[model samples]
Target chain A: MTHDLTTLVPLPVLIPLCAAGLALALHRHPRAQRTISVVALSLMLAASLGLLVAADGGPLVVDVGGWAAPVGINLVADRLAALMLSVSGVVLLCVLLYSLSEGMTESADGLPTPGGEDPIPVAIYHPTYLVLAAGVANAFLSGDLFNLYVGFEILLAASYVLLTLGGTGARIRAGAVYVVVSLLSSILFFVAIALAYAATGTVNLAQLAQRIPEIDPGVALLLELLLLLAFGIKAAIFPLSAWLPDSYPTAPAPVTAVFAGLLTKVGVYAIIRTQTLLFPDSPGVDRVLMVLALLTMVVGILGAVAQDDLKRLLSFTLVSHIGYMIFGVGLASEAGMAAAVFYVAHHITVQTALFLVTGLVERRAGTTSLDHLGGLARVAPGLAVLFFIPAMNLAGIPPLSGFLGKVGLLESGVRDGGTLAWVLVAGSVVTSLLTLYAVVKAWNKAFWQEVPAGVTRDVRLPRGMVGPTTALVAFGVLLTVVAGPLYGYADRAARTSMDGHTYVDAVFPGGSERGRGESPEAGGGDP
Target chain B: MNPEMVPSGVLVVAIGVLFAAGVYLLLERSLTRVLLGFILVGNGANLLMLVAGGRAGGAPIAGITPVDEMSDPLAQAMVLTSIVITLALTAFVLAMAYRSWQLNGHDEVADDVEDRRIARLAARNAPVYRDVDQGEAGTLDEDAAAARDETERDEAGDKTGEAT
Candidate 1:
């Protein structure tokens, strides 16, 4: 009478992994491959939703190859993992749908339609996109450090292909930098894992949690630092964030939006996991994190302010706003972590929505350069309304998810009232103001002002493309409206992550570090 | 313990030197030098990992327990993974260099700030003629002809000597 819902755990990873191979096979059969990719992704989205429902009250752990605890790698999906995965699934589904609707070929209306000379085939874009989404899901669900590294490689490999899909001169050049930096970070991650393994003899995050405490304090600190450096590079924390804005804006709108929305946050998520689970006792890490958070905020927004290109400006702000999440994590309070988790969810939606809106703006206005785009509201009032809500939310205005996430972090920081927390609080307020200014600058230039004389009227995006952008924006606003439920989920996730014992016991049984923790039979039988 | 006690300390210092030099070269605009810098950084990071693995002795293989030590196999494995990834990246970046050289006729990084300003200026003052041709021309491929038509219109308008 077993329903075998746990079988769903590996399906999300397996589907995409298989799709990557299938995608390569269908490279020749472009249409069939696209069908397979889209179907596979849709199934994955459905599976992710089911897992979310099943995991509503508790953690779901899948031990691979039927191996027992501590030896077999595990994939654990808790509330935070489930929420991130759900958002990623939904957003990617929208992007894939939009890509299909728009047709893979055509340059925001600049290129000829399909069946014309040099058809822009959907084949290359769709499959690689699925692979990317799959990698994101794997990263979110992985319970082992080494497995997470592999997930990152999967994502990076697919992104490298996607980023260079067009093989344009600019794209190739940008992809080159993006690929190299990502590879370097991956290597660093390997090094960090090696060190951690040396100290703990295991790569399972749960096992490491129990063992890391026994390792020499100095060695543990060194390992933590190495791991932090690696993840920080990926997340594009203040100092290591330089490669992002330069590379992201070079890709097509969907590619850029997905990368901006999901990829860096993966890095941030990794950092959160490592700090909370692996080295919770690492002294002075929070202080370092606080300082880095502030710098990330200041430098990122300043970079955004200086950019004239709408996409590039948004990209900078994307990196800058990462500081808020990092700040919440650095606070190391339960409220702080919950706020950080909520912020991650909120930012992913708003950021993705904004980027998609930018694509629409580019399509209608002939470019994303604010100076060149003026008075867009006059001709494209639909676009103006579409872009405005997320734009205001991004600047942290009230009733939106963005503002709620920010307020959560600021309140936690202010409540903590340490010097680092004070700095974070002050920096949060300042960065929000600066963020508002940057977004308004874009609005004034692109929407409010009179349309410049030289602008063309020929730019017309398909209904399919606009539909996704509008949907994501509406979805973000909905989250803002339904803040209570989302916050409760985030709070639960934060509490569970900090508890560590609940997570620890789920992977082990009597072997757990939790004193009163329930065993496998008491909850769900291991068999 | 003195920092100079281990003979491998020199290798560690060498790693530092590689890092500093690589970072300096990476900052340069030239593509080849940047590639070289990346290689150097890779090596330095590898050395750093190896050093962190503990005093190196012999090659680390399984089932070997020596007198108080074994060449930290974990570090060796880490280095191996990193080496493979670095090799892949090096090959990929070289391909990029080749393509960039083919397209731009130079391997230096583009001056993004300066180019952006120029692009902004050009976009801001785009002629009235550009807009008119866009109305009639269906695509960007006909952009040049569109610009030409718009320029002709502007000239004709100028000839009429009426400012609208």
Candidate 2:
């Protein structure tokens, strides 16, 4: 059973990659491209769900090319990884559907008339989207540090293409900042990996977990800080986050939605994995993380409060809420990790749903500028409902997944009882209230105010687009409904991760030397 | 760990200088310079990976060299992968820079529009956006009196004037 599941682990990464090639081949046939993308992603989603169930028993590890763990690239679908993959799988599929519908609507509206802003470059969009999905899955499942870096590069590369699609002046401007910043981060991460390999002679994460603690304390801290720095920029934690809001709001809506939803969380996921599995007892670093989390929350939401554009505001809130997950991680407790996991899952769905709704709003009102949007509640009541559920949920209203995730984090924060943790708790509460105020202000301006002059109200939202967005919103609500089992799984995942041996042992059974094709000179294999 | 496998100081110094110059160029506004900086930094990192592999030695082909005399093949393999990735990304950044040049007649990175708008508003001491709930610019008493709808005025208007 475990071996069968191990085979399933690579499918999430493989299927989309293969499909990407096929989709590119069929690009001339947009119909075939759409079919390939949808079918491929749907299959990947199913594989991810299967992995999620199998991972519940224990992590399923696959040494790629049949090489042993330490010598070859491996993919491990552990509980945390499987959960991330499943959530991302769901998000990727929904966004693909939404973008496809958007493309259809654009062409239907008589787009692609010679020189009229080509309709989303349908030929390139499907392929790049699939590659992005593959990259994200690979990142979630990678067991080797270098493989993880490869995954990051894959996703970042795809994102750069998506962000600057159509090469508009605004997009080019934003992409420049985003690309340069991401390149710098990747270099830093590359340096870190090299240094880590120098220090410990291996980059397999499970092996690193064993060796890292044995290295010089200063060297270990250096490696940890370097990794954190790279991930911090990617995750958009306060001082490193200014580029996100500027860059994200310029992209087309579905592209921005997926970037907003999944990309930063991948970084957060990395931090969680590394902190728990590799450096488990670093109180000092955890405290610093706590401080950073507080600053990220306060500063990010404050930025959100000042935004006039709906996408920009949501982007800022996305940055702020990441702090909540960071806070949960910094607490370094099981409950905290569990809450952080749940929060990540909840935030991904809500943030993407809100962005999708913003896309709908833009379609209806001809802009995402809150200052110009008005009377949406009366003009497009369905869009209003779609927007409101996720908006209020994002603000942490009761009985929603967002509220539950926040409550879980706050409870864990109070349980932590340290001074920094208390401050973070207070900071989180303040951020939540400010978030409420900001979204409410936006709600009033965009949905309730009198319709501004010259704004059209008669544009209808395509059912195809609305269907995916509503399904995603419903999925978010279902998270609240099934909070019991999900939180339980998260708690178990946290416990397993917090005890690093479960992971290490999973990779190297009976303590070592179980995988096939182990090279003799690799030192752990038979001499 | 082998005692004789220490890397040369020259390579270390070279890596340092490359990174320093790369980061310096990276801070420049020109996208071309940024791309150049990225290339420099990428090469510097590749060199660092080389240094991490220990002193250079013969290839690890089975009969060509003894295991002890062979350099760490894994690091070399990783460096090769990183180099390819860097090359691909360099091409991408180059294309983007060209696109920027084409679009704006210069490849200099521009400021965020929203940030600039907010800065302008701050300089002028204006509210970010007008809020209807704030009830226009007025003192509390004046605004409250203006907000009131008097029945007497309504009745008089209905009887004698065009209330509609």
Candidate 3:
């Protein structure tokens, strides 16, 4: 049934973007707005799954406005993009459910009251969040550099709204920092795109993949460096990552969770895409990536150890684990890339689930600070269970998907053995163990430790919140249950990425060399 | 393809200066300056696209200018797109600065308490601390004293004592 569902490829992105406007228009009727968003994302998830299935057979490409590749904007749903889209769709759906359950769409307060006085607050969150999802989908599906930039901007603009939902002092403070940092990254990205177009006279990824390798060595290196810098800031690699630990923890829980789970991964995805597709054979560049990977892992985990706040600890670990993916990327091997893809999928699910559980912790205890939070296990075993599963999974506990991902990556790292690879391998293990220690410490303090004298112990456990948490946790476990198949998918996707010619052909069908600007042919250059 | 209306050399120098100034302002504590620096960088990038288009000849307007005679229209489109993006995002940042001022009466992006603590600790870990013992041995050097004074400054700069 999904054999020829290429037509469904663009629907995942197009639906949510159109729904964002529809949702905003119906903001006065939040029920209608909620219905629109839920219906739209549900459709997105379904279509994305279908696309994922179809893309496994082959990549699907579409040119918007009937324009050809190189001239018109294109959307390509290859295996990796399909995996990202489907997984993110599921995550977004769960987050939206959690938000609705938590009354994030209803009141100025995190808590819900029937018919709250403030209309704009409730009205704004749904549309912006959907727009953010749309932007993410657009980025994954976009086949051109300019469209990718547009995708980043779409999500970032939505994120500005999401980050400062309540306009509280700390939220505003953090939101300002996030906006500024993100703006800088986007501007750099814009500059990079311009420079790339100036050099190659084309912004299409497939075409660039063909032309970049043939360009002047100096210009090519400069373009690659510029792109790396832009994406590095976006991905928050070690030296460039300081802004993340500060900006992320201050947003409301679901927003923070979504940002952590999918936003940074988008940057990582772009890195993987550009490095493999555009500048595939840069050996020196791979080494530099390896060094950065090692540093990001060690520094991020050590920072996690020093944190007393659960959210901050998770944020650090988030940065640390990005190193693991980079390790895979740096290996520049099929196995390495496969493992990286698998790890990205696993991390996104587990991280979002952790933050969702953290939100529950906040809702139940009024804080996530380990100093104030204690004995959660005794009062709320269910919340403790919810937190414990994803937390352990995040720490790479055996039999969980996280462990499987780590082992896959380690195996690949060991296979791609060199001095740098070995160092990265050691760094990955250390990061894993430190991650375990940090989460365990949280487990000891927030769950197992004695309840403090004055701290509030029991609170209403809303199913709206708890139910989605359980669902996501179950999904994480399910990844483990299907590890064999999921890893296979990752391996295949990585193989596809390793083979760049397929991507170019899928986009151009009959090679980009044939099209030498008919207009340019009319003007001066060879016809 | 329009004749290289803007000299390539001038644009590269302008972009370099603009990018340098943008990076400088971004490093500062002030949000307004950061915005201005970003604007400069954006204009510089736009100029770069123009230079990338090759020596311009004419506008690549269909049914009019010959293709070979035309300026690179795609490059022009991308620049227009980037300009729009920069304008929108810069406005958003301006709003963010305004909100921050309204909330805290400052446009500075304050370093997180945890980050400051980490920095202070890292600063303390410098090899200069090993010279504290060296000072007792008759070589109370400038490096050691400077390091000590820097630590003292960090201690004074942060009012909240470390808890752990």
Candidate 4:
């Protein structure tokens, strides 16, 4: 049974998927649907924790349905993969709680219907949310590139439904932009997959890790570029990122928070995987990524500075902070990669927490518009405190996890010792300062300023909403308290990601790099 | 694996043409054309995968193969998966376009006001590096700061009209 723990890798996707079907079937019973979804998610969290602990020893590779690797689907949970699962699981569980507490569970139209006549079918939200989780889980654990692409499609499809849940005009408009942009990128991803297979004859990550280096350098670079462009659009990097600020801010709060936190990070995760496992030998790609990272930081914050709406401002900042992770990825060093991984985990919590708090603010106040918001600090002092902690944490305030992650990244950047790297270091510092400025400005407008005469109504927040947000805030604080061990773990995870042998070995097993160089038939090496 | 078995060059030219048309439509603001572009691109990619699978021949049935020179089933499987994905996305995008048409009377993607604002600001904006002493000479520092804040507030006030 203990040996079978690695088998739990697929359980995260499986449990949620099964729950989604069950929940959808029970749509008339909202309470049962919530119970089913929550129970399934809690189970996933536990399994994710188990996977995290088991994976710490080494990569835990489970060939699904007992099929051999390369040909059959495989789920590999190394430290990096496990950490992503655990972190996202935490965020999802918390966001679900927050939405429930906020009474944001909905009918198909995403609004609470009056009486029992047209019942608000909270059932649909649960199933869609579950499917989204399954998709995220699949992406994190997939060993094959095609499987990863499927994971992305699953998540994006769920997200499309989630984004337009309420069917408001704004949401619909946002959904259109989102769908178009997403489709365009996914098509590119398909083309990239096609081209990669054309070049190498296999789409398994481990096999590609071996074979890609053997191809003509130009072809390899072209393949890597196609993959990057595809993932980059999804990640919301600059030049490819204009649609994000327009798209994310219009979704409902919980949807927006989750999208801000998890969705783009999936893209970042893919970029990290490709940079390390598949294209580690390409320094030029790393440099190109670094420059893009710098541009993303500068451009994103500038947009942030110009925004007056809270959600849009946060959306822009979300784009800005992604630069930090990309900066980490481009370093292509163990330390750089570790810091990047650490920063990713840190950003997910802090950004999601901030967005969740914004939701709370919106509930208390009438809106998240900075101009209309003021005097929240004096009125809803508790909400003000909630908003303050995460805002400061986001700004890289000392002793907070955000600061630690940035320092780790900066330390790595300095150690890399190139003019380009230093330029990124300077851009990162500027971006951090500007991020602090933007969020603090938001704090001053939304919390610190005096409330207007007419705006001093009831500010009481429901216990349910406050409880989950407090939990997330506490979780963010816990990252700081456990900074030593967490950073150590990230450092180790980084080292693991940088080394391709562990991944190659975990998936390939006794079959040495035979997936590459040989024919595609050889990789499938059937019974 | 054999050199002679790569897909016909004609397939490559067709894919290129499909990609070119797809990109041209993708750059348009009309949602219908964008959707069309997306479809074309997806088809192009599927065709690329077909070509990538080498020259097509026999069905990849398990055991008792009709011919050993079977098309690469993996690439076929990938294309099938992508086709399903593309179909699903097309339905979703069609709904979005329909909804957009219902609300706005046309299916054009509305330009983001903020994007336009930022672009305009960037175009007209040059570096403003005002020294503290010279710019506000003979004026109270608090007044200068207040002036700056007022300009910010006015700009923010202008933004308040957007209704989020």
Candidate 4 residue spans exceeding 4 A from truth: A105-121, A511-527, B116-164
Q: Model 4: which docking level applies?
A: acceptable
Model 2 misplaced stretches (Cα beyond 4 Å): A104-120, A513-527, B118-164
Instruction: Assess every candidate by TM-score.
Output: 0.83, 0.92, 0.90, 0.90
Model 2 Cα lDDT, one tens digit per residue, B57-80: 899776999977898898899999
> What lDDT score goes with residue A87 in model 4?
91
Candidate 1 chain B has its poorest 10 consecutive residues by lDDT at: B140-149
Tell me the lDDT of candidate 1. 0.76
Candidate 3 Cα outliers beyond 4 Å, as residue runs:
A1-4, A105-119, A512-527, B1-7, B118-164
**Candidate 4, DockQ score (0 to 1):** 0.30
lDDT of each residue in A90-164, candidate 3, tens digit only: 899999988886766334334334345655677888889999999999999989998999999999899888988
lDDT of 1 at A180: 61
Candidate 1 local lDDT, residue A226: 88
Model 4 vs truth, CA RMSD: 7.1
Query: Which pairs of residues collide in model 1?
Result: A105-A120, B129-B150
Worst 10 residues of 3 chain A by lDDT: A518-527
Which candidate number maximizes DockQ? 4
How many angstroms is residue A411 displaced in model 4 relative to the true structure, after the best TM-score fit? 0.7
Error of 3 at B93 (Å): 1.4
Which candidate, 1 or 3, would have the higher DockQ against the true structure?
A: 3
Fnat per model, in the order shown: 0.19, 0.57, 0.54, 0.62
Model 4 C-alpha lDDT per residue in residues A383-472, reported as the tens digit of each score:
888888888888899999999999999999999999999999999999999999999888888888767567765756788889988899
Order the numbered candidates by lDDT, best leading.
Answer: 2, 4, 3, 1
